[model samples]
Target: MVAQDFIVDLNKPLVFQVGHLGEAYQEWVHQPIVSKEGPRFFESDFWEFLTRTVWWAVPLIWLPVVCWCISMSIRMGHSLPQISLMVVSGIFIWTLLEYTLHRFLFHIETKSYWGNTIHYLLHGCHHKHPMDGLRLVFPPTATAVLCLPFWNLVQLMSTPSITPALFGGGLLGYVIYDVTHYYLHHGQPSSEVPRNLKKYHLNHHFRIQNQGFGITSSLWDKVFGTLPQSKAAKKSR
Candidate 1:
């Protein structure tokens, strides 16, 4: 397909219109940057799609792969419900992975030489430019780099079939978690739950950097007992 120009009407939720297809897309709409809450930069449709479409599409890419896996698993003797369970299990596995990476890796305070360098390379850059498009999520190269080792490790004790099903599900979940984390930072939440999570995440960025460690959920913080306790203290005064 040829490249297309599109405009986003921020007033409408989650829709894009193609203006014209050309060598590249262009933006032809803009809205006033004013709101009851504060100033808002009404995003162009092209920009919104650029930000959102891939994240929306990622889990989709896994669906066919997962469906194939599920079908194969059933043919290989697993029940249909077990295949269904694999999908659900994949999501929960993603939660734990997301939590562990956020708490330990992203939040690791590096006082030494290489530690700080690696820390910044991995996440500090994102903290600095939370809005940078190219850096929104760890690129596929980075994902592959991190995923390969664990993928190999899982192979040591488990069947080859288990690896893809498990890893595909976990990777799908990671995509969701990573994109959700990005949205929590950059996109406006539609409901109270995400709004609250957004607030919790903002606190991680601005207020208490050490608290609100869980991005997908506060489950780990509650589980490990490291969740921030001082936000209320500051607010109650």
Candidate 2:
């Protein structure tokens, strides 16, 4: 049975209703709705604004940090080629990280009250209202919060000189992912690659949710056997 339009009471907390749907939650959340308006996460307008992110805000906020980190690596004695290699590696690593997060965290299967609420706030809202332009990109505030431990991890895993450049590359990959994600939802593609990507991503949103977890690149999907059940998969065999 197709899910009918759900009328969330703006006066009440959205989490209590949609978040407590239990078994009905998965199917309800997956059924995409076409609307520019997104549900309110909080009653406070000030806090609510933090939940919505403009796509341009990503690059505007992070690009300078990326450039700074890379430039810092150069000052720390890493050559351009070495820094470039680390940066590329970081971007490549980001692709795998992207796949892992999308599949494991964002799409986590849960039935607990808090779990469901968190899931809905983090990603289900996006799935439910796919066309809400404001929520397409993650809020910079949330991203900044996430960056702390990630930066520490990068520092520990790599040499000091490489860490800055590598982390910057990973950040760049994230920026590209967010922007590409927004464009895939809102932009018209005139080229083959983007056109296919748009199709691939839409398949994830409108078709099967278990597959095609990669956004900027489908490399992990092909490797992990989660590629969508479409002609592309058939041809790959």
Best candidate per lDDT, number? Answer: 2
Candidate 2 structure quality by residue, lDDT tens digits, 1-237: 222344456457575567556656787788888888777777778878888888999999999999999999999998888998988988898899899999999999866657778899889988988999999999999999988888997898899888999999999999999999999999999999999999999989988888999999789999999987787777999
Query: What C-alpha lDDT, on a 0 to 100 scale, does residue 69 get in candidate 2?
Result: 94
Clashing residue pairs in candidate 2 are none
What clash count goes with each model?
1, 0
Task: Give the whole-model CA lDDT for all candidates, comma-separated.
Answer: 0.57, 0.87
How would you encode candidate 1's per-residue C-alpha lDDT over 1-237 as one tens digit per residue?
333423334344311222221222111111112222211222475533333224445455545655665565566676657666665666677787777777788766554435544554566545544554444565544565777775675466357656556655666677778777768866898899999888887767666666677887888888888677665676998
Q: Tell me, by TM-score, which candidate is best.
A: 2
For residue 227, give model 1's deviation from the true position in Å: 1.8
